[model samples]
Target: MPKKIVKKGKKSHKNKPTSKKYTKYKIDGDKITRERNCPRCGPGIFLMKAKNRVYCGKCTYSEFESKK
Candidate 1:
């Protein structure tokens, strides 16, 4: 018996929402709010701020917070 060849389909991204359309920055009276993005991935990707470090889930990038 001969094996049948199958063609691969187009690449697909996960069903979850990848990026938010709204600005990450927020305004509170006279103050401005914002989120830090991943340096390696550029805009649209935000880093998760932890107690000691900031991390990016997409590229596994992280930076430790400096002690002051």
Candidate 2:
């Protein structure tokens, strides 16, 4: 005879995020402009842009939008 074993919690099935690095730059005429960078992290580090704010992944610095 064997005792019944129970499984605990269900595992998360979240999808992996995609890379959109190539979309970050803009080319207009002869000028090239890029997205904003993290103030705390300086030039090389870029801020992640969202619908209402932009934030830094490394430093966790966030800036929200102002209410109109």
Candidate 3:
């Protein structure tokens, strides 16, 4: 005797709910305060916040060195 094969449709997987969910960090406007130093840069280097990266105030160089 041969066993019967079952064919699944597209809706089979689509109907299943996700096991994990993603959450983002939220900042409180009233409680949160901005720091002067750049988080990306290590200590001893004084950096100022630029558009996206932090720039070293003393050397006038960006904390994120350009690749290549």
For model 1, give the 10-residue run with minimal summed lDDT.
Answer: 17-26
Evaluate all candidate structures by whole-model CA lDDT and list the values in order. Answer: 0.80, 0.80, 0.50
| Segments in model 1 whose C-alpha atoms lie over 4 Å from true places | 1-27
The TM-score values for the models, in the order shown, are: 0.54, 0.53, 0.27
Candidate 3 lDDT over residue span 1-68, tens digit each: 79788876665455545431111112467654333444445454546556676676556667554555
| Model 1 Cα lDDT, one tens digit per residue, 1-68 | 89888878977967965455334566779988666889999998887778899988889999998898
TM-score of 3: 0.27
Report the poorest 10 consecutive residues by lDDT, candidate 3: 18-27
Summed backbone clashes in each candidate are: 0, 0, 0
CA shift of 21, model 1, Å = 8.1
Candidate 3, lDDT over the whole model: 0.50
The per-prediction CA RMSD against the true structure, in angstroms, equals 5.7, 5.8, 14.4
lDDT of 2 at 52: 91
